[model samples]
Target: MRSYLTRLLIVIQFVIIIFGLLQNENRAFLKQLFLRSDAVLFNGSLYRLYLHQQKPRDSMLVASHAVDDYSWLGAEPFLVIAHGLGPKLYGGDNTIKTLVKGRERGFRVYEVDISLTADNVLVCYHGGDETEINAMRYADYLAVCRSKGQDPCRFDDIVSYARKNPAVSFVLDVKNRFYDAYGMIRNAVGDQNLGKSFIPQVYDFEQLPFIRKDGLFAGEIFTSYRSALTNRQIFDYSKKYDVKVITLTLQRFVEQKGDFPRDLVILTHPVNDPFIAADVKKLGARGIYTSYITHRSIPELFTSALFFTPLKQV
Candidate 1:
């Protein structure tokens, strides 16, 4: 009878453990579903998905590295303006106009390409021929520009622009997917010997080491994911690379529920509510990314202030 009772107790414990595991798995799956749904909702329409699908794909390791260094150096908060469909949709003049206005308004600007390709050429436009951009080299793209009037501006041109405007920094968002293309961009950017006069901001975190090696721009990387595993993987990568600044979508930050490791700068879209912004700051976020600064303009509403006020003596 004693042996039988002991065996039964063991079986009950095992079942309880299994049930807990199943519950955890279910919660994780639900969280993932929610994240995907939220991403679609945030875009506001299925048309946005199609628009994103049509963009170029290229690895942006160099840009990622640049962002990392910039954050490490403690730069001011800035805005990232995305230009879609290349220079044809929004010409260089329009693009420059927007960037100039952002600067005049006391904001820094970073431009990202929408296309992804193997050559990993990150230029000033948003979307391009994904198939053609990925299949051909940057040089080939230049040739097409000369022949077909497709390419808008060169990376070097942006560098020169940054040199001319000392107060502004260029954020290059590489939309590429291939990893090797990152190295190609680094090579094109040349050795880090370029003085601080021409450093541009890069937004990819994976390219931190390359940019550090290249010695051109000083910026930090921004990465986002919909799943916990991917987020953890990125966090691990950041640790290994010693990255200091990280960017996440507002949804991801909320879903994590204050579980994110602290002490690093967290950048996210601006929130208008003073309470919510205070909550987010309480959760350890360091900066807010916004289309306009007005969203977070409340004075004396920081997280630290709310939590650390001295108590009156009784």
Candidate 2:
């Protein structure tokens, strides 16, 4: 009877474990367990995307090295982590909690993906290529995302947080279009004279004059160029506008033998290679964006025995 009872208890516990895994309320918590790269999304019950890290690193090994992860780059050549504390580093992306944690870890500048809802409310989300999202109301979007185990960051919340934490700065990456972008932006700005604290990224050059008309959004505008021809045009037009930053996709940045365009703050994304990081440094990059900025050091950006080798921070 004792043996049978013990066996039954073990089976019961096993069943309970499996049941919990299936009905898990903490999907975000579960993501930290199997995440290979930065973040993996589980849409309620259907989707399971394993975002295999571009170069897989052991989470435990990375976590163990955090304290001594010799930070090489200070303010200049400023490091901006796209979408807040990289999903891999913080177990999620762009959440108010994750961003606050990043600031605690000494990260100052953050790039957040922004979109305007059907109700004219600006919300924070990286809904690129998700065409259906264009039609959803703010509440509807939030509900669907939440029901799908996603936490949507509110633009108002992020703005307020920035106001409270003056030391921290934000780079708003416009993910989708808005009807009255100026009003939405000004409303987000609220009372914070976020002079240098805020930088608005624009894709269309025509939007610049309108955005600048407010005067409150008087910070340097960040724009990108597709072709070399477009690059030259933007450069020429920049002489008339206050476009002070140029962002290039990491793929394009890597294609260049030398560095990005000089004189402006050139920031590239998802750059994980030390060789590339070093080359960009030599090319006079204003900054490099990496998901592992907190988990690893930029090569040659830190003091190490192998002068050029960046020591991993995990």
Candidate 3:
């Protein structure tokens, strides 16, 4: 691994020099570049590993088998997040228009953040760092989003649309720890007969025990991985519960890891760069979880499963 470290450092140094030369004024662009640099560094090192593969086709990223593709069902493609109408970073946050755009892009599964207003209403809103959305009720929350021109809507607002489009699915990333919040969301989804259409993306592993008590199936819901769990523990949890799990992994864990289970999907926040998608695959993940919508997220899978070709591939 000594040579690997050397190569990584060299790539990082090269990236810094290139950034200095560009001298762009946009802070968002610069921030995105810096975030993507890790993937570039990791992918650069991966080329070396590929040069010395131990088996025939061991280096190829293209997975022919459905199970190896990070999909529980073989028939559908697993690349899920497409925020807003377009894949551009400077787009609206989870708008109805964006959901329509994701469908236009051939994505069946769309991830949306759900925050509970203090009055127990679930709304589609992005949870800001350190911001507790549940502290406010529907009126305050709606005003806040409207003030920012975010075009936010209630969870039921989106689910009603899902009910209309039978093929579409929504993965709800709940932002509230309130018991009533869960109950309200469950009621809204069930009342619309869209329970199967919506999937809960829960954060706390400690809440797993309460999942069933709260009316949920382990295999149906996904866990948003935290630093509290190691890669091995994450793998074990998914295996035991038969649930899909999402892990936040930077380059530090990518190249060094030797194996990964098929259900463990690796997620990177605001993944503007597409190379990170390829690198995630290199880490043996099922797919990637990203907020920014882009077909280039995983060009290989994007092209292979274009239009989610078959309804049931398994």
Please write out the lDDT profile of model 1 over residues 1-314, one tens digit for every residue: 99999778756754554465468765555444543543443331332353343211234343234333453233433323322211223234224554554455445444344333446555544445556566766676556556645445655555566656655444445545434544544545453533343333334343455556645555445455212223444565565555655667676666556677665556654343445556666665665544333223444553235643321211
lDDT on C-alpha atoms for all candidate structures:
0.47, 0.54, 0.53
Q: In model 2, what is the error at residue 2, expressed in angstroms?
A: 97
Cα lDDT tens digits, model 2, 1-314, are: 99999778756754554455676595443432322111222221121222221211123111111221112223444464544544435545667767776665556667776777767777767665535546657888678667756567788888778778876667777666643655687766855356445666666555565555544543544455322223344455454454666666654444443434455566676565656565565555667665555423443453222224332222
RMSD, one per candidate, in order? 11.6, 17.8, 11.9
Among these predictions, the greatest lDDT belongs to 2
Q: What is the lDDT of residue 32 in candidate 3?
A: 37
Candidate 3 on 131-169: residue-level lDDT in tens? 567577688877886787766677777868977986666
Task: Tell me how far the alpha carbon of residue 47 in candidate 1 is from the true structure, in angstroms, after superposition.
Answer: 24
- Pairs that collide in candidate 2 are 38-88, 62-314
For candidate 2, the C-alpha RMSD (Å) to the true structure equals: 17.8
Model 1 weakest lDDT span, ten residues long: 79-88
Q: Where does candidate 3 have its weakest 10-residue lDDT segment?
A: 305-314
